[model samples]
Structure formats: C-alpha cells, structure tokens
Target chain A: MITIRIPTPLRSMTGGKSEIEGKGASIGELIEQMNADHPGLKDRLCDEQGEIRRFINVYLNEEDIRFLTGKDTPVKDGDEVSIVPAIAGGAHD
Target chain B: MFIIPSDIWEDMIDHARGHAPRECCGMLAGTDNRVTRQYRITNILAKLNEAELARFDQPKLSDLKQLAPEERADIAFQMDARELSQAQKDIRQRGIELQAFYHSHTMSPARPSATDITLAMEFEHCRAALNLPQPLHVIVSLEDRDHPVMRAYRIEASRATEVPVRRQ
Candidate 1:
C-alpha cells in the first residue's frame, strides 16, 4: 500500500483525513484507486484530459514526479506521495 | 482583528515606502492576534509560471521570459519557499505562530483583489502542508504614496471578511 497525503483545501471532501492508503503500482494507478474510494478526488488532482493540474505538485518520496516519469512514475509499497498547491498572486495594480 | 505595536506598524509602512512602485511581502508572527515579529521575504513575483501569470495582467509569456527578476519585481511578488521554511522555523523557535502574510498593493486598494483572493484561497489550501494556521491576509495600499492604507482580512474560498487592525 502507498500512502497519499492530501492537502488542506481538499481535505473537506476527504472528511479531513490528512493521509490515506491505497493500492497501486504507479502514481497514476494510486490516484485512480484513491479517487475510486473518494469520489471527486480525481477531478481536483487531474483535469478533463487526465493531466495533473499545473498548479498542483506531486512528490513521491520527496522527488517531484514532473521531473521524474510523471504519472507513469513507479510507486512501490510503503512509498509516500504528497500533493502540494502553489501559493501565489499579486499581479493586479 | 490584529493588534500591531506602533513601532512595528511604522516599520511596515516604511517597508512599503522602501519598495514603492513594487510590492513588498512578508509574514508576521505573533500570538493572541498580536504581531510580535515580521519576516521580510524576497518577492519573486515575476518568476511565477505562465499559468499563474495569465490570471493577472496580460503580460505575454515571451515578454516575461525576456525580463530579469529585478524587472519582474515591479508588478508581481513571489516568496521563496526555502526562505519561508526558514522563517517558519525561526518563528516556531520563538514560540510564536505565523499570524498574517502581508503585501503592498502599490496601485490597488487595501482590499484583496480577485488574484489576491485566489492566492489567499491557495494559501488556505496549502496551510495544512506547512502546519500553519489560516493566516489573515493583509494588504498595504500605497496608491497615494504619501498616505498608505493597511487592512487585514480572512480570505476563504472566494469571500473575504475584514479583520480590524488596532495600532497598539
């Protein structure tokens, strides 16, 4: 089982569970299984094209998936995944 | 509401003045809704990705890519993640929590703009990952240059609620 860490904003949908365990062999599979258990989770994690949102960063064991193999990044049992959103703004005025 | 000592309050104003024309950003740390310390962070506003930039002004990605960090600092602000982590650690060591994140709005009002509100919402979304409280977003508007207006608010989702600030 791989552990997925959910961010705060999306926590309201997961009943405030900070972390959850799911079964998957890759990052994509992990998100798929986790979303099956927690509906709407997939929408927040991915777009209509099934691509990770640009603002969201996912790291596997401290390595950014984007720099790795992306969704195809392999995930083994006991691996930890974290989802982080970019906090930015102030372009007005 | 936030209680800011007179000297500290002045410092914030001065900071805004020092960075006039450009936005300055920092985090305030304190307890009981009172600010005790302020951490000035380097604003990397123009360094943000294209997707985030598109929501604000229509600065072509090509144009932004051509300018340097110093040039970009004039219109946007971004806090370095490493510096933020260090500040958070120092604040925790001082036994104080991060109370608010403040930024200067050189050309806007003392209220959060649509972009600011979106960022504040993102801040709330990312707070748990940082183990910090939902910060009161503070804006220092320097539209007049001579007179500045500072206001605080709790921005959630798309709504903002003003939090009165008292000068102690």
Candidate 2:
C-alpha cells in the first residue's frame, strides 16, 4: 500500500481527505488508480500530455521524484508520497 | 492600464497595510482589465506544517520570529492552497473571471521583481496553452507606510510592462 498526500488545493475533489492509500507499482499507476476511484483529480495533477503540472511537485520519502525518475518512480508498501504546490515569486533583488 | 474604483483601490491598500512587514496577497475578479471585486486569501507560508494549516478555524499569527531572519526579511507571498481553490470557485460562480493577481511589497517599490516575472511566466504559459486571458499583476508597495503606492503591470516571459492605473 502506498500513502499519497494530497495538497490543500485538490482537497475538495478528495472530499477533504488529506491522505489516501492505494496500491500501485509505480507513481503513474498510483495516479491512475486514484483517478479511477476519484474523478477530476488526474486532470488537475497531469496536463493534457499526461505530464505533471509545472507548479506541482511530487516527493517520495522526502526525495523529489522529478529529479529522479519522474512518473516511473517505483512505489512499495509503507512508502509515503507528498504532493506540494511550489512556493514561487519573491524579491529577486 | 487597469481601472479600479477609488473605494476598491483603498480596500486593497488597507489589506496591504494590515499585513505590513510581511507581504499579503489576494484575488481580484472582474473583466477586461478592470477589477470588480477582491477576495483576501490567507498567506500560509508562516505555518510550519499541514496539520497546522488544516485548522483554518483558528486565527493565524505570522510571528516573524518563527521564520528565519532571511525569510522574514524578504517580501514574498504564498496563499493557502485550499483558500485559493475556493476563491477560484467563488469567482466562477459569480460569472466573472480572475482578472488580476494582487500582492504587496512591504519595503520595496511597487514593481514586479524578477521572481514575480518568473511566476507570471509560468501562469502565462499555462493560460496561453489553454487559450485563457492573462491576468494583470497588481502590486501595492507600503514603503512609506502612510503613503502607499499601488501599480499594475503585465508580465511576460522576458519583460514586465507597467500598466497605467486609473480611477473608474
């Protein structure tokens, strides 16, 4: 079982549940399985090209999956995945 | 140029002042580069965890001492994700569009900085791909505290153009 943490923005689609448990071999399959159960989530998480939205960051046990293997990143029992919105914009001066 | 009524403009400035020393942000709904209404969203960066964030019924106190000196020193804005999503829905239900993004510059000038340009570019990228209208960036600078300066701009991938602000 994989524990996926949902960001606050998409909490409404998840019925206000912050975390969900699902089973999948990879991150991609987990997203698919979750979307199958809860609609409108995949669209917000992935773009039309099936890529993660630019502002959304997925972390596997504190490691960014994007810098590692992206959607193909493996998942296993007791693994924790966090979806965080990027904190951008500041005084670059 | 964006058109904002004197009352609405004053309200935004008041919001900026209320959160002085720490940047504040809110959403504006309207059409055609003119603002009709505004919704203030809680800035969540001051919190340290999601559980603390979930307790929205409680008031949030942004104690500068809680953050590192550097983070406290910088003028940045981060809206609570849930509040932002709800505000979007509210705008849609009102039959209006999110015409502008508003934030404050606590100690700096009323100008879009490099970081603002980058974030605006990302938003423009998504909007352009979806064929949506780009929203104006409204910055309220409280450098003088008593005499706040508010300005508007259109930010693209490379440059930011100042848009004239006028009373409606």
The numbered model that scores best in DockQ is: 1
Q: Is the docking of candidate 2 incorrect, acceptable, medium or high quality?
A: incorrect
lDDT (0-100) at residue B102 of candidate 2?
A: 84
Candidate 1 has an lDDT of 0.76
Candidate 2, A1-93: lDDT as tens digits:
888887655678888887889889999999999999789788777767897765466767756577568899999999988776643355434
For candidate 1, chain B by itself scores a TM value of 0.86
Rate residue B50 of model 2 by lDDT. 34
Q: Taking the tens digit of each residue's C-alpha lDDT, what string does model 1 give over B57-125?
A: 344334545667567655556665445655776887899998998888888788887767776775676
lDDT (10s digit) by residue, model 2, range B97-155: 88788888888899987667766665564343223467888899998888999898888
Clashes of each: 2, 0
Model 1 misplaced regions, further than 4 Å: A6-86, A91-93, B48-71
Candidate 2: stretches off by over 4 Å? A1-88, B48-74, B128-131
